[model samples]
Target: MSDHSNNNNSWHLSIVERKFLLLWCDFIIVFGAIFLAVILRSTISMDLFLQRGYFGIIFLYTSLTVAIFYIIDLYNIFLIDFWTSIVPRIFIGVALTSLLVIVSSFFLEFLALPRKSIVFMSVVIILGMMLTRYYLMIVKRYPLNIMVLGSGFAALKMIEDIKKSGSAYFHIIGIYDDDDRKHGKEVMEIPIRGGIESFAADIKELRPQMVVVSFEKEIKETWTDILLQCARSNVQVSSAVDIYCKLFGKVPSDHIDALWLLSGIQLIRKPYFIFKRFCDIIFSLIGLFIMLLIFPFVFVIMKITSPGPIFFSQVRVGLNGSHFRIHKFRTMVVDAEKRTGAVWATKGDNRITAFGKFMRKVRIDELPQCWNILKGDMSIVGPRPERPEFVDMLKERITFYDERHLVKPGLTGWAQVLYPYGNTIEDATEKLHYDLFYIRNMSVFMDMKIILKTIATVIGGRGGM
Candidate 1:
């Protein structure tokens, strides 16, 4: 086996590295903005500010601003245009952050800053972020040159996803496969340069920053030699799965096999489980309290509009493939499924009442699931629980479908936020890719990111059925 770990850090930066760089840049910008704001307002000296314990407050504000920017997708370097997508989100993030800071200052006297200083700080932060992003846009405009080492289906799919990503982060320069017949042919417009024998010459000529080994089967000795040579030359060599997951934020369910699943999946640590459970309990209690406050209004509306039970409950597949009743505010007519039996909800379904449609769009229908989360039947963030009927049917057709049950189901999930409401087997397969990715990379930070995305989804009303 070629020592893949030797060249882990290469000239080319992965998606995670780029994101981390952007995060640090924003953190610096926030700190600088605070300094400039204090100077411009001339209201507080740096020494006095620190002496008064305002440094902690400033740190909190800076952290909150960066987090808001992240939640608003300002850190999404994959966005092609800075003006079209990034600029507006920057303004929204700053505004939201300012609002939060102002609200927080009212409750905590020590957190308060002068009005002029706050305004100046917000303006400086926005300008600083825009300039920083513009610089990154120019710097990352040249996509990383990737020389693929296979012309198989996996390589083709990887190419397709790179194009679909809408960012100039990766450019497939050429492909080299062992098959004699595939030579001189094109896979999705990328030429198959030659067999593995020609890889050395091609590497020198093309001078790619990364070589992606995408073979569908075990690597031959010749290919292994090529990978070792690439490693010696300081060119990054990665499996197609690594590149795909890094770029697309999801696993390639179709390409991954049993060995990949067994080896790649990380066992959930006890601390993560405990932390997740604690969050689930606390957030669920808060959510249920909010639900209680609004229940009477929802109940009256359902009574008037749909003439049905206020709460809808159904059997769902939970952790370990066990069954549990999931509760939701009734968004459909009573006995809506009597004639049709169990089925996926479709867009603009006739069964959904007007109020129910509104509820679903805003995700108000999902609040009742907090009770389930509170009861430990679900999590605040995980794979969305599926109906037992659908789960049973999907497990038969989908590979590794049962693996999703290893973690508890959630009120909102990585799949639920990233993919649209799934109604077909194909959609379910696509979602499984995200769910598996979540399972393999489960962490408190990942869960927090999912929760932030879920909030964005609810506000945007773009992902519901």
Candidate 2:
């Protein structure tokens, strides 16, 4: 398709409106999966048609499952990088659904459904849901067209960065800069369109989708004309930092300023905190029920093989530096810390018991923290809680370290899943970048993304401590 650069009079959905449309699309896909599952189970010649109450039973079960998916933030129109990470999460969701059906068979008083039917339905639903997301990616025309207003090394670096991003649908039309020396040259096959003097006029003339002001310093005065033109003509505009987050999936560490970090929007709001706590309670209860069901098996195995308590409690710093007892299934030896105080866990650490090693690898030890979530000291998703000892040292070592305590800690976090467990000041610094990214862009949608990444991390044993 030709670029709609000159379509000045055309109407485009605002970002918020587009997000709502994607949400509606998600709802459609979920219900469609329900219908598809039914058709698969009943269309076979070996089976007679379902009875009158059959559809009602199916509807109720489907509704509950859909609600769970919604609560998991599966409906959010994930930003480009986030969308690419959806595959393994889809697998886990299907596995959990199958497990739920199997467990329900023992308690619910519904008519017996064939086990084969349930299994087939789950497989079909998983495939259907994944394909639906890919299809919607096409239809939604996502990853808006982006135009960079620079042609220097920084601009080229931006293109290279986008090259590594799998989730965005970015189409860089060309570059524009003030450097006449590099005017007609092609850097990375993206031609230099023009210089800064004509930048606004070029943008207004071309009316490209989005203008990325990528100059090194603040260009507020220079951007006024182009910003006005873009605003009036329906093109979106963003700063370098904004585009970096959209393209790279994480914030650039060098671009952050103290003022921006301390701004009004960065501060926590009362209602947001309340809502986050509410979410922690609701999900923790559900998670607790699942943990309780599995406790008998886990407890029995640990008791028979090990010589320590089933639950391990440690003092961890919570919101605003408050102390709380964090619970987990003991994943290390009783005296692991006797000789070495507060050393980070390494692969094949001798202190880890055999069962503890497995628990750590699979993250089953974290299951009990649903209780912490219930206690309001933690969230299902946020910055990983650090021990007081580590916090004290890190507070002095890492910049903006205490800022993470602005919100409650979490069970699984952006840092935990994206990066390895912190072993040193360097690792913690890298993690801090991801944590800042999470805090800046925190939302129900982002929380879901981290949760999904956490699932992948567990399954693949990736980035483990």
Candidate 3:
């Protein structure tokens, strides 16, 4: 057997595994830095450190730092550049973490650290994290060789997307297809190696770590047999759909077929939905409480600034294509949409009152949606619901568009957090990719991640209309 047949696992680390490793390393670095700071500040032994609420303080600091880093997107290792991206974000995360820790220490005396120790600890953390990131960059410099078994448009698009990702993790070594004319040609500078007839032989010669099957048409049994043989030989064989989803964290709306959609829908356990609904109710109640506290002030401001209704309600397509009235703080003139008739909101629309812009930026406009959640018309996290008019058009145009309605729409969602506000059909199509991915991978942890990201977005004032 060849060396390629020695192991079932690929030699390169997966993206998820890499992120997990980085998180663990960050935890260790943070704990070590705090330990060093405490030791330098005093002559206390390890026993004394343990007696003084060491574990509790360390856990608090480490968890908060990790969360801040995540919210700031530090764990997106593939997208990070050490100097421009990683360093500045690290500073922001550390500062935020330190501020939070100090504020928390007021309520919990044992959590307090000496000022000098905090400074020393921050310095150590910055340096340690930077070094760790630099090491990872160096190790991942060599890209994984990928042999693609198709030369279709999907293959070309996949290659283009991979390049656009700016990730040095995957390199397309060659593309193969059964078409004779394409065999001698090149797509995106990658040569078409040969026909599918020679796939088994080419695998031996090229010895690619992974083979991506991108054929849009029905693959013949012979081709399937060869792919199976590759799998049996410990070579990684994956569909372009799987690779695309893994790479971009979104489904390829253009490339996927109906069968793929049908089979790919994850069979979430009944317990997950029960738990999700429970959380939705609890969080919605908390959200509604906050809304009540702020409602009086918001009402006064709105009445003075603009003569619109305090609240706006619109019909939206919700779970299983059900229509429901979604509520939000009125952020525009009372008759803003009277002329347009349900058109998408544009950038800097004159219909929006001056204070409305501020409200949207801080996401006060969305606070009213807690009522929708409370009514079970929405979830705390899921796909953002679309207007029935827009949904009708999108369902006609975009592939798998209606699938987003399989779950209740949400006030904050994976698509809403990751993608900007959509005002065009193209933008809606792009967001659908993210929405489908969320629907397929819905879980409590996923919902929590989206909520954290949504909080970061609101704090940064990046929320768009």
Displacement of the residue 367 alpha carbon in candidate 1, Å? 1.7
Runs with alpha carbons beyond 4 Å of true place in candidate 1: 1-35, 42-115, 118-126, 138-140
Cα RMSD to the true fold for all candidates = 6.1, 7.7, 6.2
lDDT of 3 by residue, 1-465 (tens): 112332233335544556788899889888887667656766667787788877777787788789878877788744534676578778877787668767876885544668987888888888888888776674634445678998656667778888776665566767888778878777776778787766777777656667888886778787898888877766678888777776677888788776777665657788998998899899999999999999999989989989758999889999999999989998889888777888888887998889889999999899889889988999989888888988898889987898888889998888888788869888998899998888777776678768877888989989866
Index of the highest-TM-score prediction: 1
Worst 10 residues of 1 by lDDT: 1-10
Tens digits of per-residue lDDT, candidate 1, 256-339, equal 887777665556678989988999999999999999999999988788888868889999999999999999998888899999
TM-score winner, 1 or 3: 1
**TM-score (C-alpha, index-matched) for candidate 2:** 0.66
- lDDT sort, best first: 1, 3, 2
Report the lDDT tens digits of candidate 2 across residue range 386-447.
Answer: 99999999888888888788778999888887776657788888788778778776776678
In order, what lDDT does every prediction score?
0.79, 0.69, 0.78
- TM-score for candidate 3, please give it: 0.77
Q: Is candidate 1 or candidate 2 better by TM-score?
A: 1
Ranking by TM-score: 1, 3, 2
